[model samples]
Target: MEKTQILPRATEILPVMTAVMDAVDEESGKGQRDEATGPLFSENEPAAEYVTIGCSLKGGYRLTGVIAENTGESSIFIATNGQTERVAKVYHRYKKPKEEIIERIKSIRSPYVIPILEEGEIAGRFFEILPYYKNSDLLKATPLDAAFVAQVVVPQVNAALKAIHQAGIIHRDIKPNNLFFSDDRNSVIVGDFGISSILDDRQSVRLTTASRTLGYSAPETAQGFVSTESDYYSFGVSLLHLITGHDPFLGMTDQQILKVTLTDKLHIPSTVDNTIAQLIRGLTVKEREDRWGYDEVERWCEGQPVPVKENANRVKNIRPYVFNGEEIMELDKLALALAGKWDEAMKHFARGYISEHLLQIGQDLASTAADYEEETNREFGFFKLLYLLNPKAPLCWRGEFFTDLVRLGERVRECLPEINRDYADLLESGALLHFLRTKQLDPAVVDAFARLKERCRTDRNEAYYKMAFLLTGSNLMKWRGQLFDSVDALVGYLHANREGDIDAMAEELVGSKYFYAWLEHLGYGSILKQWRALPYGR
Candidate 1:
């Protein structure tokens, strides 16, 4: 069944509404109030103000009409200056744009990249204004012939990618929706750098670990690794959709997509032209090292012959292992299958079927299998086996993917009060501890897990939270749903909101002393003292 459209369409404000705003206040009081009021006035503020309802930005762009609402990261709206219209992106409260990345993007001078006209904070939220392209995004302009994409779209977007790559920015989210047509409607320009990552920066901040758009996301991204090649992988997926006139993974659930795409070869339909197929295949190679990048793509655009490198490491399933009624050739696929069917997987192991097949595949895998066989808890053994099978796959327990140790800690925090069974098993069963030891992570991180493991046995809920706090380290702490990277950030949030409930929650948390002690341990004692002295704390 098709999804019902429950919301109204995003539309421009009618002539009637603007006339009313014009009558309300002629000058509209630009920047007269304190900075705390809202978005700062744009230097190019129009003389006649019409938008009295929506907020205005410091860049002098006033949001005139809704273009897209609640887009997870930001709300898209039409901003105006009376004489011209522009696109405004009002970021969600928790999903603020990284200023460093925004600054880099602003410095880029490329016709292939959509320009950022203005950017600043308004009402404690970040916003960006861009020239409204008359032509809509590439998602709406699909079913184009392979010829046009190869000749026009590829060259333009590749150029944009080249510019951003040189700027040390990895456009993590590159798909049809984020690619827009130029004003002339002849070329494509990349937009929406909100989720892009900046390389080589030790102090870089990421909003979330798994930020890639599924289906288009590179396989390595599923395991929490992304590079310039990752962006090219997404570009390839977008090209597939444009040329094929449909999503390659359409109608498949997210899990189904991940299972197949991550483990199997991308099946470019044989019906596709050989030239276009080669380009798509090159860009979407499963191995990032073998995947085509700027140099290969640029040469292809220049009409020079570009050879697509095959993924030499992709397993050939010389002696396939049958599982869950399917022939599994690769270790990664076997790991996914076993994780999916726990009971069946255990049965296979008990029968010595899995180990037998592993021995056939390789001695190393067979050795890992032998070690897991000795685990008292079969479920925990299964988890260990899965990890051994594919260490690069997200450390999955039960069914969910906790992309990394930090993400796993976040999950534990999210499930406290009634801890997640998978989390409990991983911790209490010593599977996580085993993972920590084998992975050889930072000793401090390992020590944090040891503490977490002991706490799991004691039934102290605070210990679980403490483990989360410790594991998070310099990363943002997921607390009661809100995220805070430091005591100052938490204090700043409390000061700004100041609701009765918020203050009460703050008082309760500070009274517990767990949060206070954690902050102190991190050497934020002076900051904690001031916070406690405030009315929000005990």
Candidate 2:
């Protein structure tokens, strides 16, 4: 036979074929070649001549040519070995140290991690062989497929993480790319433990070096503190990414992401259900002490509660009776009278049937009085009437009333000394003074009013302002009848102050209607209506 010239490509292809032959030859090392067939075995012929004695390798070695392209500097081959004829991965020499590391991992007994089979120098360089995985990396799966991930994959991944932690190893790179499913989709196994750290038996699980994907590391990790809690934080972020199909800290730069994860509080989007949102938020807390532990997480997952935001709109529909306008108005009138609406004293007294709302109205009147300067006197009267009608009004309302009274008393203290004798007597009266001093006016407001009556005989301004303040109540009791004289006096003050500042005067006069009505009920309608023309359409 004439020798044929071989091109460079043909020459290059020959070495790969030779390497495959060499591997196959090593497997049949104990056997002799059959002379009849030369070195080339027939396609359908059984290799009985290549059988080794006593070592019956059941499901024996089947050396097939490299099934995949050599993407790296060397080629990879799939060889079947052992009982099941499981696929074996063969890596060429240039990728040696990593291959050796993979081989070292074979000593580990983790079901979740892929196991290495054999490693040694081949063709003057090192090579490693790992069991070829049947399924793709979890990264290749769509996160949106909830059925596959939540119901199946997630539990397995969680279990795998727990297993890894138990083995005293911290897989610093826990991410989708490192997880894989079995060919039958029956199991999940986490791989690529190259970056994992082995914790010292006595020491806790902690990472000294920062070796995590951005946006998934715990806030503490950014500060160079890594512990088991840090792993929980990363798991939380990973869960968020799976649910949202985007990084939780998306749009953030590496530095920004670290800054926020460490300092800023997290905000879960409204789109997520509350239970899950809260769980994730709890895990991502900036403080490690704040983060939930494994037991807490388990409890939450098992207890599974519906989110608060889901029921937010429904909660707004509930309203109590006190919120009704008609009921509120009735209560307001009563409160106003009790607080001392002297002008409408008789009117309120005749229609009186107090309700809880009435007391609330009294408090409202007091608040309104405190809010406006012009209405201060009128509000004081309303407060007095309320105290007189309902001696048992809440202490809170009474406290507020007394506070307002004290403030008003301070403002008028200098003026009181200059006022006429009648007013001075009213200010000095034992009942009013006692109530003012003791700060306990409940059940004493009536006597206080009587003292006002004796002083009004001479002091017009003091008695007038007092009467105006009391008669502002919308309802009144029998004793309020004495306020008619005071109501008349207050009306005079209103007329004097009315034309000076229309708005201020209007507010003062119209503000007194509650008391005016009470007085009208007591027989002063003519005067009450005359004051009503000031503002707010009476």
The number of the candidate with the highest lDDT is 1
Q: Mind giving the per-residue lDDT tens digits that candidate 1 earns over 192-263?
A: 887788876442322225455777988777665678888999999999888888888989866677775677
Per-candidate TM-score against the hidden true structure: 0.76, 0.38
Score each candidate by Cα lDDT: 0.70, 0.45
Q: RMSDs, each prediction?
A: 12.5, 39.3
lDDT of 2 at 8: 22
Q: lDDT score of model 2?
A: 0.45
| Model 2 agreement with the true structure over 323-357: per-residue lDDT tens digits | 21323323322343233323344233333323322
Off by over 4 Å in 2: 1-110, 119-131, 205-207, 249-251, 304-538
TM-score of 1: 0.76
Candidate 2 colliding pairs, count: 50
Candidate 2, TM-score vs. the true structure?
0.38
Model 1 pairs in collision: 40-58, 42-59, 42-60
